[model samples]
Target: MKFWRWLVILALYAVPVAVFFTVGVVVVWRSGRCWWLWWLAPLCWIAAYLLTRTWRKQLAPPAETGFVSPGHWTPRDGEAWHVVESHRRHVEDIAPGQLTDPHFYLQSAMDLALAVARHYHPKAKDPIGSLTVLDLLAAAQLAIEDSAQWCRQYVPASHLLTVDQWRTLGKTPAWLSAASNVTWAATVLMNPLNFGRYLIARFTTQAATQQLREHALGWFYLYFVSQVGFYLIEMNSGRLRGGAARYRRLQADLQRTADPPVGNEATSAAVTPEPPAEPLAVRIALVGQVKAGKSSLVNALLGRQQAAVDVLPQTKQVQQYELRVNATEDRLVLLDTAGYSDAGATPEQMREMQEAVRGADLVLLVMDAASPARRADVKLLGELSAWLEANLHRKPAPVLGVLTHLDQLRPTLEWTPPYAWREPSRPKEHNIAAAVAYTRQQFGTQLAEVVPVCTDVARGRAWGAYEELLPAMLGVLGEARACALLRTLHAELDAHRVQVLFQQLGRASTGLLRAGLAKLLDAPT
Candidate 1:
């Protein structure tokens, strides 16, 4: 059955090719030109096809979810991004033979992997030596899983292929390779001139084809190596797994004192000072349009009228206030930002807002229900969203929409407490619900939730400040904590990366010098 299938395939393709060759030869003979020249067109066509084809298929990053990473397992450090990008540029420059040949490919891959490992683990010449058997096995398992995922996505129904079908498919490549060798030998032996032309064409075509294959494999290894490098860095930093334990260990290390020098009892007094063990404080920024009752909300949250409340926008700068939890050190820092105008804020005001948002772990976007025009607020939200996207390595600060002036929504005479906006029965409640819905719809998924709040501090009739909004803020506390942790980690890394790198280099140079001096002393005259 296989023999018959092969015969049919050859006949189907060979007949047309033979007919075209014969017709070309006849035409060339009639024109009194060399019939061999007729093959040039086909050779050029093959070369063009090989050169024009798109070979490299893009591979996505490994699909491992970070239990602690704020932004859905994406790399949280600039160093990780740097290593991946650098490796990609280096890998793509790999020679065609190195990428296509198995032995060369493996050698090149190992060399690149070591380069990445060295960048992350600079103390060790061979970073893999530090990894245990389980670590190595885990890496292999991850690679296997990524391979399976690639097959499932790119190879379509790969799992459904029978063992016999797979074997037959595998043999197809060997048969095609043998046929190519036979064709090459036959063409070379035909005539000396033909052989020269054949060799030129074969070289051109094969070079193009090999380059395409090189690009395809280059792309595959580029993504694979990048993912491996990213995880490697994360693992080394103790951020990937056992993060809490690692954090504790880091704290312990920081608190630990160095041993005293031998025979120097006085040196024992000189110990490392323990860093202040302050709990992570969640920073919340109240941002909205001018006269959106942000100041009132701040006053209510703080249980005092500390923020100046006036008819005009009094808060010209960011005013930070601490919301301390009673009987505990756990506290939240509230940033009351200057509001944007209906037309929008000035560049300076926007800059201030951006700085406030950058430092915030959570944002409370105060929206006035009475004011239907929220274009300015929407623009601010859009800008913030873009900023967050640009900085995905940082943990995202969750935004919650606070629909303020619920009492001012409908029924001018009514001042209600405890309005059931979720399942509204009264007209005022319904209007409040509609306002919340409108806010949510306008913002889309930008807001985690919209809570209807009435921050009427001047009237002394504040509602939803403690009931709805506070609880909503506490609800996303876990997410906010993750963001805080990531924020602290990146900050610490940025501050110490250069210092640590210099220290390592200093130690390495000193050790190398010591070894050289020792060798010189031991040398015979």
Candidate 2:
């Protein structure tokens, strides 16, 4: 029904606007009436110019509603929380075949969760989160409509809606699309041919005089200068500057967490967790799908099989080991989590995994290079990276990709070893290199580094070929030490900040309580 409504709207508005624009263009070409072109150009310039000036107030997202936001989720006795659990249930219910592509299941989980939430909860008049995401979607829909309207008249009668070139364009950001539009208009103004056309059409036509064209062209050039210059600057400095500003904003927000706003009655009644203590040692989390060889790699790194390699799914859980990597008091902690497809992980197991991920200074995303489809590893990395970026507790953990089972690459019977691991000369070595390259490319910027590992030596191979993997792991940990220290410092500072805020809240509460008591005593009955 919605689709048919869209079609009707297009037919009514789009066809006529397109025809009008087309006929105007033709008249401008033959009759030299620049008014048809220059007149609309000024209106567009004014609109875009005003958009730039009033963006802040006009584009601000509505404040979150206390009755419905995720921030307001409070448990009632026997409410079941079935909606929240529905997301995880969807993951568990995925068909065995689609389980291979974990991303598909993960996306399904989010989609199902949103659907359930929408059905159960009241709809929002205005939504939150990145304003750009919603804005771009609307702009894309509108752009297609506008394009159709302007071109309808010029287009053949039989082909009014047949051309759907606009539908094929990829999802481009609104800001980028707007900049490109300005660039197109500016190109016309700067070109030698367009300048000649503008002048000749204005002087030759009775309706569009020379003065009006000059005025229109002047504003167009001014817009070109301002809009293009701003776009160029943003192309260079936008991400870095925006990140810094957001970080500062987040810090300011965190500082105010202790003091609930005047009418936020829910937060005051809710019990808050104690501030975290400073970190004692660097924590590294080893994560992957089942049979991806995370435990075997952990054993190789530890020089002992501390983690269970082949546990049954029902009994599997997060395994922790303390390996003394250095002579000093600082002992590194390694957490080996249950694989992605591990069946029936208790709520405790899930909580343990979340805690480990939240505190991890570095993550070793183990993958089986021997496997044909490596989608699970890529999906896991993306999820963890996004989690870190969105989380306020710590900075992103540096993920080092550990590609295990290199010896099992294709031709399972074949085993080559002791080859110069650094520079590849043989087919097997080249295959390993190619596998590592592909894994790195798949993970993209999420993975800090990728190192190949053959944990168990094949029947004839002399070594497991862990030469490169060990050193890379050490380098990652060494780099992560600074990040570890930063995490500790941030924890300490955040704790102190929370402590002060709570104290102030306590005093305010106490003063109010005492004042009420005094007023009660002084008042006559």
Candidate 3:
């Protein structure tokens, strides 16, 4: 494949040189201009041909005779032959047959790790506990550390070869290097000539100037094509210092098995019992429009003011807080994101919020009871719903709709309790009758139960309402939901472990390859 590619490259360069020379000669002869123009045609062709040949020679495979026996080869061939001999010697030094067939050992280790991870995927909901997952992770880490050691040991000697030493050692073929050098020299010389022609075209009146411009453009295009091709090859073939490939593969596998079961709430509840001995820690993200009182609500549930609360939009970035439910003593992480619908927020902010919510085991969509009917609030809700549908296949965590600013609503005068309520200071007549009517009308069927929350930041007494909301929120999630949430969290940890393992493996492979190559080329004959 490499030889054919080189042949095609030579053909491409040759065609252009032949055309330039033939055209240049014909023009010079007809015009009776300076004979130098005619000389240029032959000079360009010879330089181009020689450069191509040098590149090809350098690329040629090293002679096999040097590896078989040094006595049968010339002094120049000795270096090339010694590289292979040295590689074998290095392998023997480490362990007999270790360098010769390292791939089999590496592959076997990878296969074992992969099998272990797979075994634990479904049964061990807590990915960390599974023996297979842990083994895979350890394998990946070991691979990378080994590779680093190998590179440190061998790279210095590999870089010591001079042009002759390199050729002798068969590190790189002489012909290939010569051809590359010729091509590079020609390119450097031609660029100045082409630029000069462009300058002349700008300042002088010459019909040939346009032709020169076209030729320069063609060369530039060819250069760009070559550069692009080189980049593609490098990107595809280059190995990382660490086991990045193995890590990526492991990540892919984990992602496939790690996704939590969705839609079947009943089945999930059955699988995960309410009283798990140890609950997995979970992160929950709360997102909503500005002035929806997200911070105030979180503070109320936490039983402490960990987040800043203000009537004005204050949260600018995602902030996380650890909350432990008094009932279970199980820890839950609450991620409060910058308020949406703020003028300063960009699309990227919205995207970050979306991603935060995507990873959450629960999402709280807070709305203001005072302005639930407002256009901005409605639009925000619709947008959030749309985003959720587009991004998530399963229902994004258990969504709890929180209504804040309940203190502003009038309690009595035939108003609702959960939706509308009579305040404590209402008239004597506005008592149980008003509360009963409000409950019957609003909290009749739609919601499980509505708890009023006063999220007024200045009052400081509004924390009481938040206290009431917490127990209700916990009840809504229940023990079954908590177990599922724990499982999901464990799965994420498992995925991370798998990725780390594969990355290590890739590193080890790279080290082995580099070490083998170095000894083959640099060892003393």
Candidate 4:
């Protein structure tokens, strides 16, 4: 779309140059006004040059806002501007695969978790003493290492891995475990003097309280600083490799089309036809059961009060919300379907609903967290998965299970081994622990991340839990992957245009050079 727009602009500017040159040549040849007509050539050239420069400037990608230029390359400001602008564009149109890059979101979440740990457990120096802090650092480091491996394996010299793969690989429990160990080791090994001081304070001068505070602060500084450095290294590595890979792939794609022209009846007929117009955008449908808090979750994800809710099933039909991420303008077509129950839905209606779920890029299997193992929720999950396998077996989209209504979960329910969901008044620590264990077990291994959300809309507090989970969701969809996908799409569109130009040139009687020149002049600017 942008390329064609630029082509049209360039062609319009070249019109005067073409007309002036033709007129000047005719005047010199027919009227023998050589000197006067020769002057027009330079004038036409200057006009065309100026017009082309102006058009190029207009077509160039816009400069990035709020980026500080680093003085590494010559023309530092220009390079910085271009790099930032290109990255901005890439982010805007990231391919579905790139968004899944585990490193990007995994690192981000790790960074945030580390920040929290540093604040809360500043003095602890080992995983046993400060488990949360150790987990944060370990997770961040592991994510970086895993991401590096992914960069080496799948990221071609020209392109980054697709978002889906990135997310899938990043979320693996093995990666998280490795990261946890790294954090644990770092806390134990670094700055022994600080630990000694903390111990001495504990034993002597009755200043134990003050010494403990100092130790905590010192540990926090060390851990926080390391995390910052790790982020810098990881982000830089991704950018450098990603850029090089994209450039190389672009070259390869271009090279494949550099073959000599073929002239034959069969060859002419062998050309691939143009692709049908793309749907305005991808459409997604959301379906689940009644009192499932589907509407609340939809509102939270969309960041808008678009869906209505009641204690009873307020959503009766397929309600759709077109959602875009705040940071990245990636469109999500959310379809909220009528909640299923044994009583209300007919077989035909059930089949149609199942079809919608199967077609979704992702299905949000919403269930009440307070009632995690309800028969209806389990039935719905089974039905949805069955439909997808039976109908759309070739291309299966991921189903993201969502557990909602956490506030209602009995605070007193004790979580025992072989965890099961139970309702108790004034839930204790055991209950919370058991609930977590049970939820993980029920979901099985393929579950991306089970989110516990509060479904009350008036409070607007339930949505807070989603803040951390949203990035994971976006990662699954490969938000960054969209950039590469768009670039490929653009390249294909240009190749199509070039093929059309070649066909037009073949029909011309003039020499190839003259035809080329005419086509260039007539081509849309």
lDDT for predicted candidate 1 compared with the true structure? 0.67
TM for candidate 3 is 0.36
TM-score order, best first, reads 1, 2, 3, 4
lDDT against true structure, model 4: 0.48
* Shift of residue 93 alpha carbon in model 4, Å: 48
Q: Compared with the true structure, what per-residue lDDT tens digits does model 4 show for residues 1-525?
A: 146744553464455467657776457546654535434433443444444455543444433344443211113223323433333343334333434455654553445434333333456343224443323454455556656876688667415557787668767867876785565455347534334433332233223223323433433333333344333322322222233344334334333222312221122324522211332233455555677788888887776777877555544466778875443333567878777663445566577677676445556667666665456655666666565445321234455667666555564233222222234334443454465566668766535556555556675436433443465455455322222233343445456667866876876646777878989999998
User: Any runs in candidate 2 off by more than 4 Å, and if so which?
Assistant: 1-280, 313-316, 326-329, 342-352, 410-416, 457-466, 493-525
Which residue runs does candidate 4 get wrong by more than 4 Å?
1-284, 311-316, 342-349, 391-393, 412-433, 479-525
Q: List runs of model 1 lying over 4 Å from the truth.
A: 1-277, 311-316, 326-329, 505-525
Cα lDDT listed for each candidate = 0.67, 0.51, 0.48, 0.48
Q: Ten consecutive residues with minimal summed lDDT in candidate 2? A: 69-78
- What digit string (tens of lDDT, one per residue) describes model 1 on residues 313-353? 64557998998643223358999998888898789889999
Per-residue lDDT value at 324 in model 3: 66
**Per lDDT, what order, best first?**
1, 2, 4, 3
Report RMSD (Å) for each prediction in the order shown: 17.4, 21.4, 24.1, 31.1
Error of 1 at 20 (Å): 76
lDDT of 2 by residue, 213-243 (tens): 3333433333322332222222121111223
Clash counts for the predictions, in order: 0, 8, 27, 47
